[model samples]
Target chain A: MNSTPNEQVPLADNSIIDLQEVSIFYSGKIAVDKVSFPIAKNKITSIIGPSGCGKSTLLRSLNRMNDFIPGVTVDGMVTYGGQNLHGSEVDPVEVRRCIGMVFQKPNPFPKSIYKNVAWGPGINGYKDSMDELVEQSLRQAALWEEVKDRLHESALSLSGGQQQRLCIARALAMAPDVLLMDEPCSALDPISTAHIEDLLFELKSRYTIVIVTHNMQQAARISDHTAFLETGKLIEFGVTDQIFTRPQNQRTEEYVTGRFG
Target chain B: MTTDTYQAVQASNINKRSTRWAEFLIQSGLGLCALVSIITTIAIIIILGKEGFSFFQHVSPAEFFLGTRWVPLLEPQSFGVLPLVWGTLLVTFGAAVIAIPIGLASAIYLSEYASDRVRSIVKPILELLAGIPTVVYGFFALTFITPLLKGIFPDIQVFNALSGAIVVGIMVLPMIATLSDNALSAVPQTLRQGAYALGATSYEVTTQVVVPAGLSGVMASFLLAISRAIGETMAVTLAAGATPNISLTFFESIQTMTAYIVQISLGDAPAGGIAYQTLFVVAGLLFVITLILNVLSQKILMRYQEVYD
Candidate 1:
């Protein structure tokens, strides 16, 4: 199992992910229309858009999340590690195991905090030193400090913000290659938002991260690269500072300024 | 002068109206129906106590508790409740064994697997099973179910606990299924979303999240179903024979407590006869059993309640 973090650059540079002419449709209604892009290895990609945009849909498609819904079909290619994701003989369960997702709302199981983090790793059968791994994952997510003493407490007892971070920690325990987060901090308060944003900054070095955010400031502050989407279409993609300071598309400009959130 | 006289007649008159406090008293009076309920309960207890005491005067309490022979009309007239109690337990256990799996599976399918149109169609049909007259259920048990069983098992007695248990299972299935469905459906959608987001298959989520969280509700429904089975009389009387055999075999004829009460009531015993008095004692026993179960169910539900949606 030869694995490299920087394998998604390009053919010359060995890009880890390649998307070509990919479109997502839900019963003839296009959710992501003809979007093609390459995600660099170990770099954070933030998708910013108003509500109803297909940022999350695009992120979910990358991992075959849309396969669960009936009448959802993807027309195009999504290459991960030089393999087509939607190809036959490809199990979505395997794909999910590799590319895990965290949702907008916190969804901690009605389980103990330690058990919550141990769940994915245990199911995937990561043998040896499980007790240590759970601790390490929680520490990495910055949840261990506050919840370290109460690892046996029900995950529901935590504040809303803590639960979301616990969710992040749980995903990390799965040991996925890419982490897809759909508005992870939109439901948290300001302090908790800053904490999660900082955690994201810390996480990008180890994992390829794709986050969908509604907060322009969050995108500007935390993202290395930002893609703006509108009504299931990619409007623009560029460096975060460049997208905020200068814009090529009117829709992108209108959205970033809080004109029509 | 005539007009002034008419004005004087109309003077110093105020329409009578009920005060707000009087209205409050009227509402409070309606609310005190709780008192009426308490009084009815006390009256029932008093009546049962008197009748049960009179039964003990004729039949010793030790004999009632331990004696196996239950010949109420024979020359010696040995009055023991153990046979009736054992019979009640046999049928109730049989009903529960049939009800639990089928009822829970139906609930799971309805809440988790079925589509809305199917649910809408299936729910009322299930409720219709509950709404069928107990007497009709009795007749169905006797005329249809018993003969059907006899076809399958050639030696099954025409009147046995199996047929009555099956009918009662169907009758109480709706209660358990509907209650459990409500509980399972009440589990927050977020918990499910969380499981899915964690890359869990739908089967995993259903087993891991939905089932455990809904367990308390399912247990409560089970207890309630047991209570209903204990209180059932007509179907058991018709389908299960009046032999008062303390047997566990479903293929053989048996007598439940309810059936014995019905049997006693249908026949004329002297005003203070031991058999006549046993009905109250049996009723007391049934009341105690149901009360304990209800309390246990409430305790589990209240103690481990998942408060947040």
Candidate 2:
């Protein structure tokens, strides 16, 4: 029996990533069933679902970050720039360089703010002026004005909201084509969440973004496209406005209106 | 309020009162258990201080700390402790050279590279090195290491500082590795994932992120291992010769403070004699050094600890 229905949204012409019948497994048990989607370039795409619905598992597979977990196996294909990410010739490290990620919790290295932003590019042998790169990335993340004077202080000294923005700046330093965020603002306060949401809107012009969020309102507000997942299956996918206000599936409708998860 | 509900509330209050008395008694019992160790420590300090004061009357502090000669048991006795202190430092420095790099490398491998099945099997075997008796290590140094060194360096003494340092280094290897491995492992997985997400290679993540994150704990482990090496008695007493001469050459025979204490304790130094009094003074100095090291380790751990949620 087909677990995923044939209700996929129309593929975008400038899709940066394509997941074709991708199914993820932990040990032998399935976590993400056969799901297919196209991540449009320079657009914000948010995956919204109830807890344990495989949104995070699906998001991690884009950059092959799931390879770090023991006993994890992926079936089918995830392609970026006509190259299969999980191919034998491909290096996961290089893949991650082109597809940066922010975690559910703010996890800056125990380093100065400047060092946190510079570490990624420095380790990859960036030969450019590190000072300029650090400034540019922090500016892009909207964190430069507050932290400019104290760039040498430890990242841990920052508040929880500032730390999350610092993590964003750290990821932006790599200049990845796509940025994947797993509930990046969940640990933050309301003001911080609003700050990040505004920042995401500005980022949409440069990098393709894939976010998994438990907050349905956040997905409705920031995302151009939304995918509703339930029990490891994609229930519906379309423009964010359509998915939230005029969802076709019963589960998506029920979930959006606060009827049931 | 209903009479029945009042009666139920009163009965529960009486029961809670009885349990509170039992809780107080249990807490006091636990406090007494903790106080026992503190009392014993204070008692030991008092005894050592009284005896050390008498020893200081016979020997001046300036001479004991600065004078080069040490001949307490022989005639025309000179109580200068420089040679013994120098010998102990030499052995400790040599042992650190042998152990630190190897122990830290094995710790990195265990914490970062080894699979679960491999780690489970190998970690206990590595730690088994610590469980072996120090006496056996002394014998191993005398019977095996000395002969091996002598063949390489024909001028090497049979009871040389080289053999003693090598054995002591081996004795402390498991401790440094185990403690360092635990510290490295305790670094949160999220930090490692954060590094990897930045396209860091495994080596880069382990060295730059994980190692630096666990640096405080790793440093504490190193300091504690050095303290253990300084206090090591049985192995050094048997392997390092009882010659109190200040020399930097590992091929020459030397005597550490621990070895000196063992020598005097076994020999017929009459009770209450000056030679007997030297024992307490030396032991008191050793106690102070170890205490300082332990306190420094604790301070480093507390001051630099990383908090993760």
- Best by the lDDT measure: 2
lDDT of 2: 0.91
Candidate 1 residue pairs in backbone clash: A7-A16, A8-A15, A8-A16, A9-A14, A9-A15, A10-A14, A10-A15
DockQ of each: 0.39, 0.81
What 10-residue stretch in candidate 1 chain B is worst by lDDT?
A: B9-18
Assess chain B of each prediction and give its TM-score: 0.89, 0.92
Candidate 1: lDDT of B183?
Answer: 80
Error of 2 at B238 (Å): 1.2
lDDT tens digits by residue: candidate 1, A1-261: 012222232322434677788899899899888887777667777898878788888888888878767688898999997788999878777788888788898888888999899877776678979889988899889999999999999998999999999999999988888888989998999999999988987887788888899888888788767788888888887766667877888888988887887
What does the lDDT read for residue A253 in candidate 1? 90
